[model samples]
Target: MLTFFSLVAATLCVSASDSTVELTTFNAGVLAGVPLWRERMPFLLSELPNSTADVLCLQEFWLETDQLAVVNATSDAFPYHVRLETHPSATPPCDATPLQAGLVCVQTRCPSNDSVDQILCALLEENCRSELRAMGQRCLNCLVLGSPNTGLLNDPLSCAVDTGVSYSTTNGLLLLSKIPLSNTVADGYNIATGEIDIYARGYLSAEVENLGTVVCTHLPTPNADRLDAPYFGPVEFNSIEEQQNAYIQQLMNRYSSKSPLFLMGDFNHGPAIGDTVAAEFPQVYQNVLDQGFVSPAETRVGLCTSCLDNSLKSTGSANVFIDHVYVQSQHASNVVDAKRLYEAVLPIGVPLSDHYGISVTYGIPVAEDPIEEWKTAFTAWKDAFREWQKNEEEC
Candidate 1:
């Protein structure tokens, strides 16, 4: 990590015409609240300011302490920030009512949402595999959704041993910008059932003074079978690829008028699925591109984002990228530079988070005449000097 002084120097050195602003997106991993977090979080905070990012988007900031920690740490550099409240506004499918037998069907099976809810509750009680099996198809449904509610309950399943501690913490999106922000909007996805129902998965957007509309969000991880996944609600990342796309599209349509849009976050799914994957599986990156967002071309600087998530990492062995920054295609020309902040992780030789941060630079255009502006300034200075001289002579 560069020193704060070095960060300031770098910021000052960038050209005026380009007007480079560093935008960084990182997943704080604060939800886990693991022992490593105690050490890594402070270090992570110290390192960020050193990068001198003009805007920072963070995901998985579940706990109030985690939110406060980031604010306290970066308050000086990023005077403006918004931590989206986790209270979901969308209507939950099961509002204290049991899921009807045939109400929620998946793969031609009538597995009640209540059964799934029961299985989730049982898992919290630390139910064994045999016990979970007894919970039946609903448990199976949980498995299909991923993680079998292991990380959902109080006594997480063995599979979630690593992240069990974090299960209790509530995570959401955070956006911090050096520039003043206005017209803030935050909302959770519409998924009100299964594993995704527990947490608020949504996007946050705000208008920056110089920059266009800036947004930060974290999409649900791709399901085990994208083909069979339900096409309903914003939370479930199953077959409803179009629904997710629509959510973002609506945002762009609503906010693009105020400013060119810049979206940054851990989308959880991307082109990493590979071109060979089934045509039915949703291609999130391609969808974004179709919506007129421009992702940076493959470059050495844009390294794999999911180094820690073995399951999601593109390569089974090596790390691959899932986090991203996208500019509204119409504003792509203003993009001065974009790259990953690969060094933001593990300053003390331990992992701060599974993913490294990424950054982008934008050059907002402004009409100006350098020579004439200088002449005008010189004329004003000369007049002021003469006035001062006359006043001095009178004295």
Candidate 2:
């Protein structure tokens, strides 16, 4: 059997020969929090073979022992290195919990003595045990939200809410790769204020060597406003917007002059692509475009409203492209084809996640084009995508 370390070595070898790489992003849909959609995860993983991406960024991935096992089994084809976001809370319960209700999972098959099962088990056990224990403790604390009691009560149901529930955590984001991840950092972005508040949202960044730098992020959702907004609660719009812009600015400042950069994630808002409240967040999307970044999925798909549920009448109207993958303009020559995967299709066997996955392919030429570099880039991108489809069939 091919060991995990060997898979990484193979990817490095492949990287050496290729001038361009493809980056794919997906919102795996909160795996652990919602039990109903859990079974459909395997089919989602099977859909995106490792051969299709050098790096895969996922949003809303809840990492736990069982969920990690499914990831390991489904991702066997892509043997590569992987990385996950760290928790944001500094305190025991919150800090001990994984970052975001969403956790980012990245993998790159490399050569090693550790079997896939062994490595996966170790990582899952460590992460799941810590997170679950923290969550259990938090649930215990939330029981006292409005109660006058200060000490731990003997009855667990004494402070329970109307629903008789205490704690609730959701999946955040994930990143998987076929190459090693360097300089990984996780921070949060408040869309309302555009600030990198290490307390809420989480961000992860790393150098991909030949691929320059790739950053994976999971921003705060509007759900937070329901709890804190005044009229509706605290509309974290400003904070969320500010942080989104800040993250882009930080990326440009750090690597603008070095190499190409790609930022992928679930922004939780739909800009001009669709008629949604999120579409109003022009500042964030503008920053990305201004930074010489283009969203391949948006350019090709055009206002994707893939998220649908038969149970609802507004199924089609709810369509919007919230998930995205951005690539630098200079590297435009390498793009082969860019489009969204799993658009309207429900996750695996069930309606798991609320969003779909987006992907983009790039083909670096043996020689640079003297003119119309984009034309050459598109041609190669098309060819690469075809090859990818063929590989998927074989797999």
Candidate 3:
């Protein structure tokens, strides 16, 4: 019992070492058909291997091909990576069409011999979509946008199908590291944002040898509140955001002892004090701040990642400092540098992305902790031991 207590006390004490990590977080605005994506995406992909940043937490790399391109390009230099594939908050136009006002591509998938009225009523639904998807691009286009542009596949006889999802948009988050990373895992929020788990906007995190866990994620826009919660006046977070913050808190409790825990990505809201927009609508940003991760400090305050000054920024893009990088205060010893990246056009005659990137250079304490699985077992034992002692004392 004394030995167990000694180990518990030892676990409480953490020693810090000096090991610096340079991480850059960027929102690569590569939305398809959006302005300049075609030009900017190819350029970014071609030059990603050349990036000197030690770690990259990127958002909006929307397509599977784009994600693979970076993985392949940086295979040698930045060898390790995690695809933080968040689910799209909004689904594609597949569910409805402009042609029909309150209905989805007709209605149901009927047989090839169905009558004309039945065929017209049968929109490219569950079974219809599968059949339409296999009918080649012309027909696949109909399956995708719910528009039979050619009007050729509108007939039930020409219906088709496939389960592949490459044609649609995903959450578009990615992480890359030159340093070795282990226990790569993707986690989604248990409480649904906007009342649906399908909006897979969650997080991806992994272990960095003796350093700490690095996480990347993209929070949704504030207006899209979680539908499951009751309204209790103007609260800081909708139940979903509270759940999101709690998840981060859990990680800090789990790892700040072992090393600096980094939470980096597009928070979709700016710093409450520095950015005017965020100060006006502070709830989204404030909820995260309450989590207690080390902020970038006042020095980097007011820096707008998605500013209109960037030539590549889309029209009506809010000028706010949403993209961020933060570590737990206990591990504040880790931050050696904090700055923004790619404000202007690069050597390739184009901007790296629509939104500027954030770079954080920090030192990692080299004292190693047990890997996740072992740590979980040990923590369980420690908790159980503590509880048993409490009951014995009560008796």
TM-score of each: 0.63, 0.56, 0.61
User: What's the C-alpha lDDT at position 236 in model 2?
Assistant: 32
What's the ranking of the predictions by TM-score, best on top? 1, 3, 2
Model 2 lDDT tens row, 67-121: 3543575466545434442332323333322422212221222223322222223
The order by descending lDDT is: 3, 1, 2
Worst 10 residues of 3 by lDDT: 144-153
TM-score for candidate 1, please give it.
0.63
Scored by CA lDDT, what does every candidate get? 0.56, 0.50, 0.58
* Candidate 3 lDDT score at position 19: 72
Worst 10 residues of 2 by lDDT: 225-234
User: Against the true structure, what is every candidate's RMSD?
Assistant: 11.6, 18.0, 14.6
Judge candidate 3 against the unseen true structure and give its global Cα lDDT, from 0 to 1.
0.58
Candidate number of the best TM-score: 1
Displacement of the residue 162 alpha carbon in candidate 2, Å: 22
- Please provide, for model 3 over 367-390, each residue's C-alpha lDDT reduced to its tens digit, 9 standing for 90 to 100: 555675467557867876786687
